[model samples]
Every structure is written in structure tokens, then in C-alpha cells.
Target: MSDPVRPGAVRAATLTRQPAFWVVAALLAAGAVRIAQITGRFLGVYPLATVTAMLLFALLAVPFWLFLSELDFLEREPASLRILAFAWGGLVATSVSIPGSNSLENLIAKLGSPNLAADWGAALAGPTVEEIAKTLGVVAIVLIARPQVNSVLDGVVYGALVGLGFQIVEDVVFAVGAVAQAGQGDQIQPVITTFLVRGFLAGVWSHTLFGALAGAGIGYLVVNPDRTRAHRLAMAGLALFGAWASHVLWNSPLFREGLGDGAVALLAVLVFKGLPPLLLILYLVRRAHDSEAAYYVAKLADLRDPVLITDGELRVLGSGTRRAAARRHAAARAGRRGRAAVRRLQRAQARLAVELSRDADPDLRHSAEVQRQRTALTELGHPEAVEGDPSWRHTVSTVGTTVVAVAVLWAALSFLGNG
Candidate 1:
């Protein structure tokens, strides 16, 4: 599942010949230095706050990293390329956005009225500069490692990572700023408050979401080699616009005045601004995943080998939900070992499918891996890892979880309102 240099990874030989490699390397180095300087100054002034913010945001990044990495698990984006995308987002985009946003903001102030700039400048300026910078991170991937980004999901993975990188770094800066503005010397209270508000509340619909929206566009442009140049470019522009518009809506002051300062109002504002993009990204991810699944699953189906993968297993492999269900189905028969065996079988089958798609002849090592997992599943007493009859337990668990989440959210909002 994790390879240092997977099939789609750019090789040293390839990098040596590509000018874009050297260019990106240089820019990343410069951006890293810029960010270090800014962060260093913050640390010098507010040692406690800066370190706390860094730790908090760094911790926050873990789940996002896992989600995006698994987003395109079948033909997974190379880890090296993924790291590059994150580096670009954290160092390049954040560094550029810091000053680029300010310059654009001043322009907005001069061109429009001060009141207009004060109100709408962030909506306009931040999205325009930041999105461009982040989307360029995707483009840089195309320039340097085109192989890893063969699918639309590949673009989303890279784009979201770039956004995640930028989001974490930007959030850290903002958190420390919040502490400084609290007028309390190097306190963790403001940092914690910012974590709850910005990291917890706004995070789902923040930079990563915008990056995915835009990345979907870039992915469409790159992957659709069949489409006309004009059409591809137009779609990419449309996608970028969607990302920028989403950012604008999130940052705009239009909703703030209408919604009062209460926590419920804040919750409503978050839902109004965030839910649309969240749904959009979900739709895009599902579509991209289905397309990729169909491509790889078809290859496995062509094998027509029961020992390697049966029709039922292929069906399970074709869907993320069914794949999870298969594991649960296995767990019901045996236990944790059954679940683990099912997961391994799925991964092996996926790897074999990917190999079959790329190479006309199946890779022996991958095929052997699939058979090995199948053998383990047999030993676990759940031979076929296909999903069984739908369970009432799953339904009850889902409903119960949903209820608890809603109740907790209501409680938090009520407490905030009271405060």
C-alpha cells in the first residue's frame, strides 16, 4: 500500500532530464526559507503560542493526509509526488499569499472606496491570489510528475494536499496572530479558541475543499487527452472559477451581518457557506472514483480466475461501500483477523488490477500477493471476502452515530450561545 517509488513515481533518470524539476526545487527552497523567517519571528515573540499553534495544526493535518491519500487508493498518487504537492501548498502558496494578498488588497482599496475595500477586498483579493497560487501547485505537479496524475482523482489528491499544506501553515499563522491580538501575553487560550473555531468548525470547507474543486478542473484538463484544447482549457477555467467563487463566498461579509453573533448563527453561517462545496467535492470524488474503479475492475474481471478474484470479489472491489461491507461481513463470520484478511485481499486485488491495466501481462509479484491474501482469508474461515447480506447492525450503528453527533453539536452551540 505504501511504496517509496511506486509505478507512477517519477524516476531519477526522468527528473535529471526535466527542467521543471530544478525550477520547482528552487522555488520550494525559496518558499521554505520565507516561511521559516516568518515562523521564526513569531517564535521569537510568542514562543508558547507559536509552538502550541504549530503542534495543534500539525496534529490536525493527520486525518486530512490520510483521507486524501486514500481518496484514489486504486491507482494511488505516488507518495513523492503527494509530498511535493503538500510542500508547494505549505511553502509556495502560503509564502506568496501572505504578500500577494496584501498587495491585491491595497489595489482594491485604491480602485474602490475604502468601505468597499474593507468589506469586499478579502473576498476578492484573497481568493484571486491564493487560489492561483494553490492551483499552480497542481500545475507544477503536471510539469514535474505527469505520470502520477493520469486520473481526475489524482488531481484532487494533489490539489487537496496542496490546500491542506497551505491550510495548516496559514491556520498556524492566524492562530498565533489571534494570541497576539488577544493582548494576553503568549496565552494558549486564544490558540485553543482559534483551533475550535477555525480548525474544527471552518476546516471541512476551507482551503482543502477549494483546492479539490480547482484540482478537479486541472485534472479534467490534463486527463482528457481526447478533448479539444479549447474545451479542456475552458473546463479548467470553469473549475478554477468554482474554487475561487467558493472561497469568496466563505470570506465575504454578506452572511455575517444577516446572521447574528450567536453560536447558532455562526453554525448556520458555516453550513450555508461550507455545505455546497462539501457536497460538490463529494460528488466529484465519487464520480472520479467510479470511473477509476470501472477501469481497473474491468481488467480484473477479464482475468476470470476464481482463485485470484471471483465475480463477487470483483463486485466488492468496484465499490468503496461494498468493499467496507465485505470487511464487516468477514468480521461477522470470524473476528478482527477476518476483517484484516478482507482488507489485505482488497488491496492485493486493487494492486493486481492496476498492474493489469498498465501491463498486458499481470505482474507475478502482485498476482502472488492476491493469492496469498485469499489463502489467509480461507484460513480465517471467510474464504470469499465478498459482502454478504446487508446487516441491521450496520444500519443501527449508523443511525446511532448520527444521533449522537447531532446532539453533541447542539450542546456545543447552546453552550456558546449562553456564553
Candidate 2:
């Protein structure tokens, strides 16, 4: 009996050790492979060229990802679902739409005249089909992951990611095509420059922006499902109209003529055309963020804790300085544990705050109340302190509005100057 028991215990210990060994081995293998690939790719090329391009892509993509992630706080959805939204845009949507549009254009050309086909391709094919296709990605996201999309901002962010993905892939193909067409002795500098300008700057307003605008309408429709059919139809119409208008203005020959004259035309398009819609979207996002903050603050009022969250504390929650101070205070008291708790509370508070801002159903209100109480118990000790004042809410709203307005104004002016 003793011999059998001893062997069993040893076997169990070995099994546990095996998993740990394998995990470490796998990680080491992955790292080694990555290093080898990087070294081999850069061996003959310019020392820092590949590295520089990667860094540039990271710089551009990371901010866009962060912006979308932040807006996600308002909706309270899973990251996986959000990514799925982007994947659908890039994969299924792009694949089907591109081929379908090409087929249709070819058919039209054969039936009519080649010049007529070219005219239709320029005016209708690019704007109508591409916008519809990209916007469908946003719609699919809303359909499949309804909970993830709460506002127009969410639509914009997701739509933008999809568009960005499409644009990046398309640009790569264009660059390679240019190189191939130019034949053996041609310099690739012109192709590279074209990729930078068209893929980076103009990409911002391309398919992604249009999809976002349309997505906002879709999100609004879904959010307000109780509306009359006529109202929903009207909103849908508006969304599609907004998307097509943006696409048309972006692809139109008027702007193309300006590019030849100087940077002025490009500047005009960016400022007068691009800045206004972007500003409008930002304004809407600010409102959503403020509303979310107010909801959580209100929920805390019911907790009755001792670490009284004053109107001032609520104000601090809205401002970066105040949040930092809270983190410092918590960290000082509890060290690492306290800091972690503070961060968790901050996120919880933000979520509950957003929930409270909306006139929630009874079930939602009750759920939020319970969560608020629990969070208060964990962080502030039981009976969490709560102070009431509507003015604090106003202050937060005012600050957010002012900040967004200033940003829009600055961008608009910069665009105008460039034009």
C-alpha cells in the first residue's frame, strides 16, 4: 500500500512538471524563430529600412486601435467580438464585394461601350459599390455582435479598422503592380512615395470613414428598436446618404484637379470636407463618454460608504489629474495590492457610471446597484461615501465639449492652411 501511494504521488508531481517544461520550451522556440526571421530578412536589405516601416505601421495602427478600444468602454463589449467586427470587414466583406463589383463592371462594359463602362466605373462603381460593401461590414458586425455596438462612434471605429485593413492590402498590391509594370531597371522610389501619401493620409477618409458614418446610423437604429418603421427607414436612408456623399466627395474629379495645382486642393478637401464630419463624430463621442461617467457616479450614491466619493472625487474621475491622484493615494496605502484594486475600481466605476447615465430598465438598474455596492465594499469599505450634486455632471460635460471643440477647430485650421 505504501509503495503504491508513493508512486502515485510521484506520478502526479511529474505530470505537473511536464506541462511547465513544455510551456517554457515552446516560448523559447517561438522567440528563436522570430529572431532568425528578422535577421535573415534584413541581412541584404538596408539595415533599418524594414524596422522603420514596421515602426511606422505600429505608430499609425496602434493609435487607431486605442481610440476604438476606448470608445468600447461605453458599450462594454468583449475585445474578441470587436476584433471579429474588424475581421468581417476585412475578410468576408472585402472578398465578396471586390469580385462582385469587378464582374458587374466587366458585364456593363461588354454590353455598352468601353468609354461608357469607364465613365460608370468612375462615377458609380467606386462610390456606390465600394461604399455599400464596406458599410456592409459594419452592418454585419452590428448584426452578429449587437451588444458591442452602442453608438455611432463604435460604428466609426470598427468601420475605420476594416477600411484601414482594406486600404493597406490594396496599397501593397498597387505598389507591387507599379514595380512590376515599370520592368527591371526602374527605381521604386515613386511607387513608395505614392504608397505613403495615398495609403497614409487619404486612407483616413477612405472606405473606413464612410463605413463608420453608415455604421452610426445602423447602431442608432438598433439602439432605438422601439421606433416606428418609418423612422427607422429614414435613419437608414440618412446613413447611406452620408456614406455615399463622403465617398463621392472623396473620389470626385474636382479634388483630383486640385492635387495637380498644388497642396492647396488637398488641404481644402481635408479641411472643408473632412474636418467637419470628423468634428461632428468627435462631438457625439464626447457626449457618450460624459453620459457614461454620470451613470456610474449616480450608482455610487446608493452605496453609503465611508471613503466618501465627493463631487470633487467624481470631478477627479473625469479629469486625468484627479484619476492619477486617486491611483497614488491607493498605491501609497496598499502598495501593489492597493494600486491594482484602485485600477479595478476605476474601470468598474466608469462602467456603472455610464449605465446610470441612461434611463435603464429596472433589471439593469438593479444589477448596476448591486455591482456598485460590491465594488464599494471591496475598495472603500462597506457603506461607501456618496455626495450628490448635478453641477458636477455639468462640469464634466462642459470640459469634454470644450476640449473636443478646440481639437476640431485646430484640425480645421491646419487643413485650411495646407490647402
Candidate 3:
């Protein structure tokens, strides 16, 4: 998955000795302190609205956190580093961008006229300042923990978390701002409206998605040592530009103004601005995850131990879809415990692959764990080595899922149209 830091590669400077570690640490601390002050003031001024905003965004963060953390299941990024990336976005990037975007917007007004600033300042300045700042959160991870970022998907996960952090905090600020503007006396209607519009409607294509696009570039830059440095840098630059352009378009009213009034037109504008990047990021995630799963599953195949991972299981292990189908098959065969056992076996097999990659099994540590999981499967009469559902079943399920997804999309769009 990450040939750049393969076993026996030249070791980077250790964390204690790296000056970049201290620099990042100092910046994070300062950002946290500043954010805390601002949050304190916001609460003091509008306790109900502030609390409502925080609760809504905090709940929203859970699914994003779980999904991103699990993207690279074969070699999941460590929790601490993921949290660090989020903090960098929530605390550091948001803190910097508040003043930075404002300053840049003022400069634009001075140079291009107030009318220009009013029309385009947020589109230009916010993305310009915030994207760079959020991108640096990924950079900070690479600088501080180079070994942890050995996959493009790693960058995507970290970037998504950072963007998620920024998004939640920025949205809270905006929710409060909306409250202040409404002069609603700390009522929660604005907070709820903000939650639906920002956290529900636009959340999927907002900062988190942008961060992931940029993070994929950083991951490529770090992991793909086979390419020329110039070529790698160019790809990374292109990814970042794509992220910025997507953000600018999402923020800009230039296109929305032409879409005219009414919810139908507004829905069209939202889809036009958001859908391309959503598709792009989905494609990237699938591509990266499949490549990673293949690499690790191959490692498991080398051992040729059915107890650890059977041939049937090997086929399923390399694909997330098959893995899920296998679990469903187990549930039908046995029950709830059977489903759980199959899941455990799959996870154990994946972990064994990770350990096998390093040849660090002098004592058969990870192998023993896989065997234990296998034994549990045996007890439950649901061995981890069953052929998955037939191609026809998969085709039916795929079509069913697509139909459901389309139905949901139509429902959401109709709701927005009615709004």
C-alpha cells in the first residue's frame, strides 16, 4: 500500500528530534486557546443558541468520524493522529481563517471596489485562506508522524477529519451569527435552521469533502516514490487546486444568481455546485481502498493457512462488499452470534495480514489471534471460509441499493424544493 516507507527504508528523524513537531505543537496549542476564548464568549453571549449549535454539530461529527476512520480498513490510521488532524482543522485552521479571510476580503474590497467584495469576497477569500490552512493540517501530520501517512487513503481520512472539524466549528460560528442577526434573543430556531441547511443539506460536499480531495494529493506525494518528484508535486498541486475550485464554486453566488428564484431552481444550483466533486471523491476512495485491500489480502494469501484465512475468505477479504455479504450469509446460516463471529474473523484475518507484511511473526502473535477468531467461528458453525453469495445475488443487491439511493435523493430534493 505504501512502498515509500516499506520495511528497511531509510528511517526519518525521530519525533523527539524533529523541530517540526514543536512548531506544529505550538501552533495547535495557540489555536486551541484562541478557539476556547471565542467559544467562551459565544456561550456567554448566547448560551441556548451556542449550546444548541455545539450539540447539533457534535452529533453530526460522529458518523463522519466513524466513516473516515474506517475507509482504509486494511491499515487504518491511528486514532491519536486522526484526532490531531481534526484539532488542527477545528482549532488551528478555523482560528486562522477567521481573521485571515476577513483581512483578505477587506483587501479585495480596497482593490476591486466594495461591490466586487460584496459579490465575490467570500468565494475568493474564504476558500483561498481556509483551504490552505486546512491543507496544512494534513501537512502537519506528515511532518510530525511521517510513518503514519503511508497511504493516499490515510491522507483522505485525515483531511476529511480536518475539514470536518473546520466545518463543525465554522458552522457553529455561522449559526450564532445567524442568531445575532435575527435578534431572536438566544432562541433555537436559527440554530435548527442552520443545522438543516449547513450540517444536513450542504454538509456532504462542504469542507470535509474538499479536505479529502486535497489530502489525497498529499498522500500521493508521500507514498508514490516511484514517480519523479516533479510529477508527484504537480499531481498534488492539481488536487489542491481542484479542492479550492470546488470550494470557491460552492461559496460563490455568481452561478446561483443566474439560477433565478424558487426551490426547484435552488435545488438545481446546489446539485450543480456539489455533485461533481462528490462523485470525484467517491471514485478516489473506491480506487484507493481497493488497491490497499488487494495489497494486504495478498500478504494473507502467502501464508496459505485456512485456519487463519481460507481461500473462500481470501476472495471476500479483498473486497468490502464481499466481506459484508459473507457476514450476511453467516447471519442466515447461524444467527446474530454467527454474524458477529464472521466479522471478528474477518478483522482478525485483516490484522494478520498487517502483521504478516512485516514478517514480525517470530512468535506467531497475530496468527494466534486469527486462529482464536477462527475457533469462535467454528463454535458458532459459521466458519470464515464460506463461498460468498452468487453473482446474481450481488447484482440484485446492487440494483436494489441503487434504487433505494435514487429514491432517497429524490425525497431530499423534493424536501428542499418545498422549503
Candidate 4:
């Protein structure tokens, strides 16, 4: 729905430019300082290799981080606050969660019960505290800027980014520590190998996916007010269970044997345990996308400008890639104004979908629907001409999903076999 309290376009435009400019400038300055430090390093430090490992870990993390950051649902909040929340998740949340869990395990062990430590680490500390701490970013976002979280996926994306941040920092620390502890004059190859395996292979299951699953539960609770507290609690339980199970399986002694045995066991576990939940989540996302598209299509039916959007365009918008392509086409033809209009229409449709999913008072929902329709109509200008058939979206989504599934399966197999 149209936010009656939407920021003035002029102010938003000015603020938008500042983020890009500052981010670039900051990155450049940091890069320069890092290069100088590395060049000045002494013989004891393999500065070049250390820097490379850090950079590689960061590079490995960028795709996941960018994926989470690109989510439009988070744009409502002040950019600085959002960045701070992510940084907090990466640094403070991770720092505390890791050492805190370790301390708990040590306490359990010191109590002359090592088995208890292992059990608690797997069942409680790993899932309960870590998942909550990782997902605190979503909580902060919701409490500080409630409007930013309009859908379950928004929470998932934000939480996943926070997790990715934590994973990257943790991996870099491990790599650097490995080299430092290897003693003076030792080869850096082992540290490099550790970086590759941890940063690339195992990183997917680290904080990112755990936070995503937990965030999904939290998102369901925040957006679905009609759900009873008991139901919300159950959802939380299921999410934590999933996170813990995944972590436990990944860290299980079964993998201590070699990659082949580990791969077989892990594959069986993932198929039975992991794939179903992820599939269900994907189904929910598709339903939400379709509902959003349908609402906007219906709302704009009465517009005098019949060319604002077509059934074909609505179909295209039902999938992520196609929607992106459509926006790019519009921007290329009609400039920033057209792109902004498309974004507004998309956001209005998304908000309308979220409202539809809720059990809000009938009058409130109806009013929201009306507002969304009006906003959509106002923003949808002349439709830009684009090439390719409408069936392209289905093809794209199918190919993209298949590729991701295969890649994930391969990674799982590799980790199970190698670990």
C-alpha cells in the first residue's frame, strides 16, 4: 500500500546518492590502508598470503551478502541503522555466541560430564542461543523499523546477510589464526587450504542458512498476527529444530571417517531432513509472488491507460529474474523516472499481498487494498516494449531452481565426503 508518510522524493533521492558515494569512498580508503600495511609487514608474517586469504573469504561471502542486501523489503529503514544492525550481527553477535557457547561447553565439561557438554552443545547451545542471536538482526529491524519487514522473505534475507557477515569474519579469523599458530617459517599452504574449504564448501551451512531458517520462523510470527502464541511458539520450535539438526548432522562424528562415507550419510540426511522444508519455503515464496502479481493485475484493470501493464507483464513479474529484466527494460527506455515508477508499483503490489495474507480487520484490509490500487495506478506509466516470449519466466525460474538445487547437492556431497 502507499505509505501516506512516504519520504519526500527530493530527500530520498539525495539520501540515495550519498550511500553509493560513501560506500565506494570507504571501500577505496580501506583498500589503500590494507595494501600499505601488507607492504610494510615483517619477515615473520606472511602478509601477502594472509591478506589474500582475507580477501578471498570476503569475496566468497559477497554473493550471499549482496543477495540479502538487494532485497527491497529492507529499504524502509535508515540505511545507516540497517548497516549497523548487520555489523552488530557479524561482530558482536558472532563474537558472543561463539565464545559463550564454548564457555558453556567448558563449564559442562568441568562439571565432570563431557557427554553432557556435547549433547547440550548440539541440542541447546548451537540451536537455541546461536539461532536467536543470529536472528536478532531481524528482531532489531522489526522493532526499530517495522515497516521495513513486509514479508517473511524480508526477514529471511536480512537474517541471512547478517549470518553471512558473521561467517566471513569468523572464517577470516580462523584462517589468520591457523597461520599465526603454525609457528614462524611454516608454509602458508595449510592455511590457504583451510580457507578454501571452510569459506567455500562449508560456509553455506554455517551462519547463513541457519539464520535464514530461523528468520523465516520469526517472519511468520511478526507478519501473522492472527496466529496464536502457541502456534508461533511451535513455528519457532520447528525452525530451531531444523537449524540444530542441520548443524548437528554437519558436525557429527559420522563425518570423521572420510569424505565418501560422510557424503553418503549426509546426502541421505539432507534428502530426508533438509529438502522438504526448503521446498515448502520455496512454495510459500512462489505463492506470495503470484498473489502480489494477481492483486496488481486486478487493481490496474480499470485504468484508462490500458498499456500501463499487460497480462504478459504480470506473468513476467511473477518470477524474480523476469521482474528484474522488465525493470531493466523500462529503465533503459524511459530513464530513472520510469524505473522509479516500476519500483513503486512493485512495492505497492508487495504490500497488498502482505495485507491479504494477514487477518487484519476487514475495513483496514479493504482500505489497504484500495490504497495499493490507487498507488499502482498512479505509478504504472506506458509499458515498455520488450523482447522474448512470456513463457521465458517459467523457463528461467525452472532453470535457475534446478541449477541451485544441483549446486547445493554437490556441495553437500563434497563436504560429507571430504570432512
The candidate that wins on TM-score is: 1
TM-scores for all candidates? Answer: 0.95, 0.62, 0.91, 0.64
Q: Single out the weakest 10-residue window by summed lDDT for candidate 2.
A: 1-10
Stretches of candidate 3 off by over 4 Å are 1-17, 260-262, 360-363, 385-419
User: Comparing candidate 2 with candidate 4, which one achieves the higher lDDT?
Assistant: 4
After superposing candidate 2 on the true structure, give the runs of residues whose Cα lies further than 4 Å from its correct spot.
1-59, 107-120, 184-191, 287-297, 300-309, 315-345, 352-419
User: Could you give candidate 4's per-residue lDDT for residues 1-419 as a string of tens digits?
Assistant: 11111211124345445554355335435534543443345223766556766678878877865655655331233455446556645655665566676776677677848887765555445555566677666666555455555556655666666677667766765676666776755456645666655765566566777767776676666666677889977986686677566655554444343333655665664454445545655564455444434544444443324344455655554456766665665665556765666665555544443343342222355445545544544455534323244455557888999999888767756753575
Tens-place lDDT per residue, model 1, 1-419, is 01211246469789758899999999999999999999999999999999999999999899889988887767777788889999999999999999999999999999888898899999999999999999999999888787777778888889999999999999999999988898979899888778877787788889999999999898888888677999999999998999999999999997877887777797998899999999998998888888888888888889989999998988888888898999999999988999999999898998898788677899899999999999999987789988889899999999999999888767667655555
lDDT for 49 in candidate 1 is: 92
Alpha-carbon shift of residue 273 in model 1 (angstroms) = 1.0
User: Per-residue lDDT tens digits of candidate 3, residues 84-174?
Assistant: 8999999999999999999999999999999999989999999999999999999988887887887788889999999999999999999
Model 3 whole-model lDDT (C-alpha atoms): 0.85
Q: For model 2, how does the per-residue alpha-carbon lDDT over 1-419 read when each residue is reduced to its tens digit?
A: 00000000113344335554344334335534543454354433433333343344445566666666765442444565456555555454555555667777787788887887776555555667766766666666554445456554556567666666556444543444444465543445535444455555665666666766776666666555567778876986797787778776665555554554434555566566666556655565565456544445555565453343445556656544456555555554545665556555556555554444444432454455545544644664322222223345447878999999767545644543443
Cα misplacement distance, residue 324 of candidate 4 (Å): 5.3
| Deviating ranges (above 4 Å) for candidate 1 | 1-9, 411-419
Candidate 4 — worst ten consecutive residues by lDDT sum? 1-10
Candidate 1 TM-score to native = 0.95
Q: Is candidate 1 or candidate 2 better by TM-score?
A: 1
